[model samples]
Target: MFLTPYVERLPYPSRTVQRAIGVAAVVTQAGIGVTGSVVRVTGSGLGCSTWPQCQPGSMVPVDHAQYQTVTQWIEFGNRLLTFVLFVAAVAAVLAAWRIVLDHPSRRRLVKLAWTLPGGIVLQAVVGGMTVLAKLEWWTVAIHFLVSTPLVWLAVLLLRAFNEGDEPPRPVVPPLARKLLVPLVVLMWLVLAAGTTVSGAGPHGGDPGTHRFQAPIETLAQIHGGLLVAYLVVLATFGLALMRGPVPAEVWRRYGAVWAVALAQGLLGSVQYALGVPEVLVALHVLGSALVIIATAALWCGSRDRGAPVSGTPAPRESGELTPAR
Candidate 1:
């Protein structure tokens, strides 16, 4: 009885609301990665000096001689973003659940929606481990690497909201489609190498943090080589696309991927040349998130999933509403 009135007054969420939730899910997922980089580059990785708490005695940041107030807040702020991401994830799950309850045929969306919240939980555990481990290079690398797949899933969730649950049909030619497999794998490789370079480079999140054992120069060369290989594969995929007619949307997405990759490459070059300045390090991390988003968009756009199915009826001019199931 206590909750009945609130439940009765709640309006059914429209398709537009669901799609907006999807978009929010994607943006928040990507935004958190950039913030994590900020924590690292600012030497605030251990700003709170403990996980699940700012310090041993406090959950919130406190004035401490051992840590600067600004640095403690920076790290605590990043931790707080996990809750924002969780909120987006919960909204996505609720939206998908409502749709599936009304139209069972759209049940597949629920699975994708669930992954967002699950991934956020996993990220939280890894983040805590990174702090507990004293910001070890590999733990930090793992923390950053986890975002790639979460970002990929977020993009897929957004695409699902805009399209049907039907099986994907490729719009690109067979060669072009097949080439994307390698292209995607190479993208992950480049990301891993980039993280490795960060591990060995100057920024270790803390002044006394342990770095990877390899020489920074050697790691940089390896990361650069992988990037060059990824570019060649992308160029080859473009040529394959040229062999046959392709959808305009596919071309646009492909161009976006190319544009992001090229700009990221340029930024990486400048970052390296400038001795990995703190500001550029943050920008480079943001660029990495963009590259993930752009490539995921390209992959999703390469396939056709037909039109979206609406769970709720068209809105009445008088704005009378049905309660969500």
Candidate 2:
């Protein structure tokens, strides 16, 4: 009876390789995010002015001064990062499939790791559509939206790698659970709303020639409104964590995320008020990525592991928090 499932698990080195794949996935996903941001900031969204190429006629352009030259390179660079991310996702899925076939509970984790590449493939399609559709609001919004779940799934795979053979962490305390999950979800929502505004707002300048009739002021208001809402929600969580009888480490993470979020929000406001110079805008996106990765790490640390460890405090769990997972 055990032969089939056990054999399935024998194709890979299991935990050791799984951990390496998990780390590589995170690094690649982050690279994709940053490189994509650079492309957007450079107004390179339509760089190729053609899907999957530098131009309609050639791969490497004969003309050095064509708009396609700079834009194609920037946009193609982002695509290259996507290819790297895809490879990492494949490694993760293979590692998971070979490591968990015999462990029934863990089999689902392997499946989830595989889902990431599917998401990235769809993202690449949408990316091409965004340029072909001339940066239409919906296509671009969908493109950015896809990355959030990819990042979240990457977090899940990493968390599973950290889990090993242990049972689920004790049920999270109700108050802390209430505080953390909602805030994390809200942070993601804020990112989604911002994407819509980005697609609709004026590109600094680009060859796409696409423009939106929606007043830039109105779009900025909408994005800023979501930002303020997230800031308030995070503050509430911070207050709740301070009052609730939770681990000190939990409190510290809450504080750190709040600090990053505040800085991000401030940079965003400066970008808006000053008309979003290219450099600051790029930093704003980087700040947003950091906030997401950090909040995810904090959430996994708090709710996913077992009993508290010694000298930390009765409420503090030692083995529970595992790096990014």
What is the TM-score of each predicted model, taking all chains together? 0.93, 0.80
Q: Candidate 1's error at 175, in angstroms? A: 0.5
Off by over 4 Å in 1: 1-10, 314-325
- The digit string of per-residue lDDT tens for model 2 on 1-325 reads 3444544434544455666888888777766766777777788877766676657777643365666566777776777777788899977876665555434446656677878899888888888887788777666667767777777678767876766435545233566567776777778878877775676656522645565557777877877777787777767766666554677767677777878888988898888888777788678767777787778877876764442121111222665421111
lDDT of 1 by residue, 1-325 (tens): 3533444454556877977998899899989988988898899999999989899999989989889999999999999999999999988887776666456678788899999999999999999999999999999999999988999999999999889878899999899999998999999999999999999988898999999999888888888888899889999989999988899998899899889999999999999898999999888888888888999999999899889875474444686654444
Pairs that collide in candidate 1 are none
Model 2: residues >4 Å from true position, as ranges?
1-17, 57-66, 101-104, 164-172, 242-244, 305-325
Native-referenced Cα lDDT, model 1: 0.87
Instruction: Please give the TM-score that candidate 2 achieves against the real structure.
Output: 0.80
Q: Rate residue 125 of model 2 by lDDT.
A: 88
